[model samples]
Target: MQLISTLATIGFVLPLFLALVGVLLARRDYGVAAAWGGGVMMALLVALAIRGVLRGDPDLPHFPSGHVTLAVAFYGGLLAIYLRGGLNRDRTAVPVILATLAAIALLEGVSRILLTEHTWVDVLGGFAVGSLGLLATGCPWAVRRIRAGSRLWLAATLAVATPIAFMTVGWLDGLIRHWVTL
Candidate 1:
């Protein structure tokens, strides 16, 4: 449970995989890609800020689970892009894929509790934060405009997210150490 939860923690897996799929199957429009990544970024930063301020348990902040937030916001945004990109044919796999992501998010949340990394409140907070982030980045709005230099936005996101990913490897013990820590 710990291992799976760790692997699912917003590292570079889901977004990268979805990006590649978008490039291969869809038009690889920068709007969709940028929005998806932007949503994840926004959610993560916001969640971290909340955790810092609220202070969860004695270790790291515990109001929200960043892993669960990432799973929902990032994976949920991917579903939005996948559907909005207009893959009308062969719709059979959509539900299956969507269900799989939902299951992953749910299990990740549960695993966090089982592993004592978070509580029910943390998981619920994660869901809320993730949803807000997804909504903020225009996920369900279907922004497909292919403006110039949109690809640069994705590269920029990667540049920003990479360093943060390192932080998730092992959070600071007994110290509120997020970039947004108050």
Candidate 2:
């Protein structure tokens, strides 16, 4: 369990750190890449949920957990973007930003531990997922799509996809829970 927990933490946090670097190094494209990656991951999770529902064997009961991941990724990415956009105006800005994000991360970690809904690894795994998101969408192809199409397309995709993402999270969570009890 300790090994799993430690690995989970590394897996979860490493990606975010990498993504942060990418975002900071003028690889703004990585930010979009991360967002789309999250969307895709959520979509896959949702698909699993639908399958479980049709089979009448909802497994996990951890949809909110999925949302928690999404929230972290979404908000973290947003903060990264804001910082990149020159919001770090004062010298204290960077520290303030880091502190706030750290607090959120700590809260998330502690909350999961207390709730017992997830192990440390599971919570940290969210961080890993978010990090991969940063790398996955940073490819040149993705940049082209974002450039060729209007922001409207991206926005529309998000609007339609968000609910699907949430549903998928819920459904898979149920399935996982059901399976574990068996």
Candidate 3:
């Protein structure tokens, strides 16, 4: 019980605080990206909520945190964008991103080991899926537009759709989990 409480507290505090920092940093140069990140996070939360409703999981509100994944993803994307500038060609950017990702994974792993959550796999899976979305959204065309500051519309779309995507994923997971039990 103490472990769960500690892990939960760590899960909530670290990710939430980092996300705020990420938003502020992104907003300094990429307001749209920051806003988009917010939108995506919100949508994901809603979707998770819906899934809990369908699954009749009374502890839906107490479910594992997806915001951690969001925090990692959002910051990861921003880092990728920043590195694209090639300010340090001799330096590696991927490693930095990977390290950040690994840190998040470690957090989740600790959470699971502490029994604060169900499994490390779920958090890792969320991290992978979230990163894929971040990569996809940071493609050449997307990167160019974001850098050029001409893709406000595209950023807005991402802001709106990412969360919806997360919600849908949560809903499907809930359905499948319930189905499997039967």
Q: Where does the lowest 10-residue lDDT sum fall in candidate 3?
A: 3-12
User: What TM-score do all the candidates reach, one by one?
Assistant: 0.68, 0.42, 0.45
Q: lDDT by residue for model 1 over 116-166, one digit each (tens)? A: 988898899999998987796575454664434443444455556545555
lDDT of each: 0.67, 0.45, 0.46
Steric clashes per prediction: 2, 20, 1
Please give the range of 10 consecutive residues that has the lowest summed lDDT in model 2: 1-10
Sorted by lDDT, highest first, which candidate order results? 1, 3, 2
- Poorest 10 consecutive residues by lDDT, candidate 1: 173-182
Per-residue lDDT of candidate 2, residues 40-115 (tens digit): 3553354345334544534433332442354355445444444434432366866776677555655665666676
What lDDT score is found at residue 70 in candidate 2? 45
As a whole number from 0 to 100, the lDDT of residue 169 in candidate 3 is 49
Query: By TM-score, how accurate is candidate 2?
Result: 0.42
Clashing pairs in 3: 47-167
**Residue 122's C-alpha lDDT in candidate 3?**
49
**TM-score leader:** 1
> Of models 2 and 3, which has the larger lDDT?
3
